[model samples]
Target chain A: MQDPFELSPSECEALLRAGVVGRIALATPTGPHIVPVNYSVVEESIVVLTSPYSLLGTHGRDSMLAFEIDQFDYEYHRGWSVVARGRAEVVTDPAEVERIRKTWPPRPWASGIRTLCLRIRWSELSGRRLGTGWQPMEDLPVHRVV
Target chain B: MQDPFELSPSECEALLRAGVVGRIALATPTGPHIVPVNYSVVEESIVVLTSPYSLLGTHGRDSMLAFEIDQFDYEYHRGWSVVARGRAEVVTDPAEVERIRKTWPPRPWASGIRTLCLRIRWSELSGRRLGTGWQPMEDLPVHRVV
Candidate 1:
């Protein structure tokens, strides 16, 4: 893809809605940490539920973080991904909780937890799609101009 | 919480053995690509079974790549990960295959056709454990300082 690094806003939105699994990258005291998490694509941000006693729960609020969603169809050898860099914080308002609850029903993944509402502050969003092979940036097809 | 970077070798070994899933990062002609696969720990190296037509079958042999395994336990806010980086290649010997197969099933994951045998040439192994709270590297206890 020519523009493999850049993704259309509409495409980015579609990718986010396609699934709830993504990799979350956060900065701990020592270094960077990444973990696969199930998240909801809300508005322009990605939301996840976890125990409130967790480190990411409190330190993540308004803190710089990144969420990545990508799918690689090995059979067809094609996939796209989106990376969202923003601040994160816990969602506490009752009305907001109601809104999120309406779409996300009680699931088995979270087991039985009530206080795991966390939202990522949306910032810059971007992504890319892989083309034929690992061609150089200048050699990709014309349609893939990033 | 200390040693956020996964500094302990034992922790690394445990993560590799305890978890049966991991993502393999490879350098394809297109660029860096990642795929989720099931693997078993063998002599400290991560071994995976793939199909002859799969990417691992094509590039896993003698190809330098990265193997990553990590787990996040949200309840205790504890998790550990181990990453092994080196060359990967196919093992064709029946005796070698039997040895590894005895330790682990021929097919490790829930999906995929298991005919390709891959052994990562583990050059360096390292790991870190995440504690409930974030702590600096210096605060972490040193064990078997590699």
Candidate 2:
């Protein structure tokens, strides 16, 4: 089997910044919930614009949340994944929210009044890459048999 | 702004069946965690193969979990997302596991010993689509000003 490799902190941060969409995980009284969102990286924090009544915006405030982004190449069997664990906070300060809007605006793909900006300052950032080592040769028994 | 639309249960199931990859959300002692995984739908349950010691394999068993899949088109601003919420169970029955393997095997993109098969029978399935309504005319004031 091939082995996966770990990515450095800087690499993780770069990937997070480059990502356009990600999944945010939140724990609620009902259960664990996950939803996709368009996001932007600003000042080393992940910012997402959402409706205050939405699932993410409602349960995410002051709660521990996880954000993840990944890309996979099916034919090449190569991929990279990044995960960020942090606490979700509402950007209440109008000045700060406006600054974020001007610099790196979070645009929701789904149309709605996304006036509330949620910021997640990750306490932990980690990433991994798949198919980085020891690809099975075509002539190998495993490949030939399969 | 364009309005988002809700998808029916049948539409949600069809989307889930068509998806090959999804994110699974789990609540742990540390926080809410989300990770991508290759999966297959069988008997109306989502199945995934993973290592017994991995975060998902270990904590996912008997836990309330959330599974999500989505697709987005940036140019047209169109997309659909589906979410499945349920409790995870380990597929320990040899015959059942073999049947699932034959029908739709879970192939992990990341290299690992993926011997354990877990199934999540979702109690709730929901979906939504974006950019399905009226589109603002490009020659309108909002477009011209921007």
Please report the candidate that would top DockQ against the real structure.
2
TM per candidate: 0.48, 0.86
What's the lDDT for residue A13 in model 2?
A: 85
lDDT of 2 by residue, A11-119 (tens): 7887787667788999989889988888888897899999899898789999999999876655666667799999989999999988997888776667778878899
lDDT of 1 by residue, A77-124 (tens): 444567676778778898988887786522223333537777886676
User: Candidates' interface RMSDs, in order?
Assistant: 14.1, 9.2
Docking class of 1: incorrect
Model 2 regions more than 4 Å off: A133-146, B133-146
Task: List clash counts for every candidate, in order.
Answer: 19, 0
Candidate topping TM-score: 2
For residues B77-132, write the lDDT of model 2, one tens digit per residue.
66677999999999999999989977877666667778888999999999877775
